[model samples]
Target: MEEEKKTVRAVERALEVLLCFASGHEWGLTEIAGQVGLHKSTVHRLLATLEDKGFVSRDAATDKYRLGLSVLELSANLWRSDDPSVALLPEMERLRDQLGETVSLYIRDRAERVRIQAVQSKQAIRRVATVGARLPLSVGASSKVLLAFAEASVREAILSDPAWPSQLDRSTVGKQLDEIVTVGYATSFEEREPGAAAVSAPIFSRSGQLVAALSVSGPSNRLTPDRMHEYAPAIMEAAHRMGTISG
Candidate 1:
């Protein structure tokens, strides 16, 4: 005979209490106890635990409890893994067609920037970017944009590490990063690869966290500094639109 599977009653009850908020309504302790068929003290204990862990929030004045920001965070993580780039692909293609350049999506991964998606330009002479390519987080437009908008601790850790260039001009880089923040975009010319130039902007989550960089790249001859400045507004606009659909 097959072994019987046992479940923890306390955990089951806690989950049921959480599910009660699925109706998008707040509940008082006694009301939740009645809904889950538990004692008032039991429900109150469950609510305390969940609230402490950020799974629920309580209104002190009303003495009511509701779902918390952590629930949205979990769903956002799932959506990011499965659908972020997919949802942005159409916008990427649109930008590529409009600018006649390659449009790529980059996310910072530790000390590198990973190209998770790209829509290459139709022109034969244009720059080619491969999806899943891992490049340094030190020189490209997308690289600097990612670093400039990264968490303060993350940026400090990477910049202070000996692995980074020892001769880097700290003052200049600081000002450049500050400018990126003020302008909402970044540009580079032959900084990562000879004959390559690009403009990039930050894509942010609904919670205002920097999630990725949206970039347009091409040959330096075609993407001159003046042209990059001209394209910056479009890049920033696309990034803003992309951020709206992100978590």
Candidate 2:
């Protein structure tokens, strides 16, 4: 039992050392020990084990430790595995083919909307936002649709975060959110990225919980205000189909 306790303690110390890199700063053994509340010698030993496993690295000249490339690679692999991107690929493709533009799937993580999947159109003038890109919740039509349908507590928590970015047109967010709920979709023209227009609708699970958002984006010239009004119903219908399949 003593040996098991010692092992757990060691693991905890190791985790603390790794977490010390969360500030995006490099630290020497003494600094890490002070932050983690462990002796310098114990911290050094833990760092050595982590370095051997390629989870941490030390700068030879400064003797300061930082996260290693292996850690980043591992994180990327895990993110890909856990992402909703794979599940929404076929739907994205269908949307792209139907709209002759870009189709994207976005999900809210904390206070941010992350693009989990995208299918580009075959047009010569296609939009180029890639999968895995992140956007602020206050910026895009897709984000507004997502926030509008999210649980009240979740939306409140997101709005409560101090790190959330400010919106360019702050006055529209509240009104747009209300419209998203009332009309079952959201539309925008050059809201986030200039020269881009989008229409988004919410996807729900079998239990009637909002899971994510589906959006069709294209050049502003091709996606005029009149065209967006016409496309809103189509986007909403696609969202319903996605919900049925997802359920």
lDDT of 1 at 41: 88
How close is every model to the real structure, measured as TM-score? 0.67, 0.68
Question: Which whole-number lDDT from 0 to 100 does residue 193 have in model 2?
Answer: 79
Instruction: Give the alpha carbon lDDT tens digit for every residue of 1-247 in model 2.
Output: 4664335777888988898876647998889989999989888889898999999999999999999888888877765533456666777787788789899899888888888778888999978767667788887889988889998787667666666665434346556677779999888899887899998899997789887999999999998889988988888888888887766
Over 1-247, each residue of candidate 1 has an lDDT whose tens digit, in order, gives 9999999998999899998875547999988998999999889898999999999999999999999899889967654544667889998999999999999999999999999889999998999998768898878999899989998898888787778876787667867888898998999999987999999999998899998999999999999999999999999999999988876
Colliding pairs, model 2: none
State each model's C-alpha RMSD to the native. 16.9, 7.3
lDDT of each: 0.90, 0.83
Q: Among all windows of ten consecutive residues in candidate 1, which has the lowest summed lDDT?
A: 75-84
Off by more than 4 A, model 1: 1-82
In model 2, which runs have C-alpha deviations exceeding 4 angstroms? 1-83, 163-172
